[model samples]
Target: MTGHHPRQAVVTGSDSGIGAATALLLAAEGYDVGLTCHEDTAGVRATAAAVEERGQRAVVEVFDASRPDAGATVDRLAEQLGGLGVLVNVAGTGHTDRVVDLPYERWRQVLATDLDGPFLCAQRAARIMIAGGHPGRIVNVTSVHEHLPRLGTAAYCSAKAGLGMLTKVLALELAEHGITVNAVAPGEIATPMTGIAEEDAYREERPGNPVGHVGHVNEVASVIGFLVSPRASYVTGASYVVDGGLSLMAAHGHDSATGWRSLS
Candidate 1:
């Protein structure tokens, strides 16, 4: 036991956005955190610093979760943490191409990174947690795109939808072992994934969101932190959407002519 503390957690794609927020918040809650950034070295370092600022141990791993060596990469992180207690799958990519024109390669890229990669990481983390005799938490940071579609993002929508299903499958399979699995699906969070700037212009332009602006990375991270905490022991296979009523726009009269209506 670390003596009145949270355990070690590996937060994937934590260089920025929701991933970075998850790392920082988890650290603040007493979890030693391992952060991975696929490409952005600077964001990786920044997140590591944030973790340390919270008085938590931080290890940074450069990882591409889509590659064949992804399992090896996660294993390296597991070694650094001495074991695993929480796995946050947040590393992902986005797209802005039409379904007809969306390159098959791009679809593969998004699926591999967003869905397949997280599946592999969660599987490996589960093995380690079980062998280490720790009942753990696995929180997949999916997107509101999983249900509510957006224009020119077929690959992203498809992949996130798959991730949602994967979360449920894992919850069912890992339940007997006491490993809880859930998802945080955020909409338009101001992160690299959304490629939206955090400025007043963008905020003022978003007229439909009940919160009246795009969500911040920390908003989603707060939900993720809760899902992994001991307080969430009874929660599993569910997704908490932090979209601030943007999804409601679809239910209301907002014309989804942004090209999202055909996803059915």
Candidate 2:
């Protein structure tokens, strides 16, 4: 069942990082992009300008992914873009507190933002695509923690793991409708979230990572671009890890770690 997926796309959390890069890449690929930001108004506007400079339509919206009403923002953006064909769920949050010290509110906040938000947004996007009688793409930006547990990121890891499973389940359910759902799991990347500048990505070296240097936002965006492209129409329910082999070092990371029991 092949259907024409529209070139219109909505990217959540496009103010910076991977989301921003993705919006630009999709624009370069002839997609009219709908970009959403949480708190960085200026950053999102700057991204929108860059998209327009790429000669594609860009719409900016303030989106708080943790809110229950977040899906409405996707609806509005899809309507503004004329219809929905691609939806990237990139808005996410993380917590560093261990489970013993993690507050319930913080746990809920992380889950709501990283997991519930994507579910709601994807639900809305899928309905629109189905109603339009066209195939679509939904990309969830998960973390390497989705597959590997970390020391102090209990909430974050749980949410991402849940999202990874959600992607597979959605793929199975939506295949008949001609929609493809997948996840992109990234390791440490040079973005504002990591407090690393893009120019410094190569300067920072991770001996544990096979790639040696931290990943750039464009690197991850390129993978996402291919997934949304017509070439990936048959691909779904897969989690593409963009981590520089960081997750692969799980055993190595714990080999000499006798202090792993303490959070400090």
Candidate 3:
């Protein structure tokens, strides 16, 4: 198994958005995919149908990422898929409340889902890969907020930043075992989470972003596909920013003299 590459992959939060796109893309690339969703049973089924239409096996599961036993869900999915050689951590929650107005429970929920969940899932997947003596890929879906601070998303930012560090640490620790860990940070993607529809991505105007439009989910998915593909075998412990240059507007964002303090 030293030189073998497993063709089975698991993607969390695959009910929609980047997760669904990633599952579909991986299936197209000849990997059987295991899809998971928290509450969107119908959405996950839809994703599965699309995967099967592409002639690849797709298994669906429903589990809350904020739960302590989320890692168990990964293990079950891996077992069902025969084995997991690629894991994409995409299940996460967002917050818009300022720190002072934020509730402790909400903070905990965001951190648990965005940070703790990925840790648990990655740990389980790494164990499976090591035990099977196979090289593996783990890609965590963070956000541009992971590297930049925002006005009202204190919890979301903190959690994503933590996950980014976790990615690097895992990459260093797992390198000797032939496992690569990386993070993909996206900005203003045309996903349900961003309140943007996939079909309207190109039509949506985002003047602040260099691309001048919202990003399509596939743009981010393509990067993840590359990270998990054989072509990126030497890439690890890196964070790929798929923001259409949105993060680069930090200086421009601050140059504004009007309503800048209230900017999100």
Number of the predicted model whose lDDT against the real structure is largest = 3
lDDT of 2 at 207: 64
Lowest summed-lDDT stretch of 10 residues in model 2?
Answer: 254-263
Instruction: Supply the TM-score for candidate 1.
Output: 0.91
* Model 2 TM-score (2 dp): 0.95
Question: Residue 4 CA error for candidate 3 (Å)?
Answer: 3.5
Worst 10 residues of 3 by lDDT: 254-263
Winner on lDDT (2 vs 3): 3
TM accuracy, model 3: 0.95
With candidate 2 superimposed using the best TM-score fit, by how many Å does residue 153's alpha carbon deviate from the native? 0.5
lDDT per residue for candidate 2 within 8-83, as digits (tens), equals 9999999999999999999999999999998999999999999999999999899988999989998999989999
Model 1: colliding residue pairs: none
lDDT of each: 0.84, 0.93, 0.93
lDDT of 1 at 168: 97
Q: Please give each candidate's TM-score.
A: 0.91, 0.95, 0.95
lDDT of 3: 0.93
Sorted on lDDT, best first, the list reads 3, 2, 1
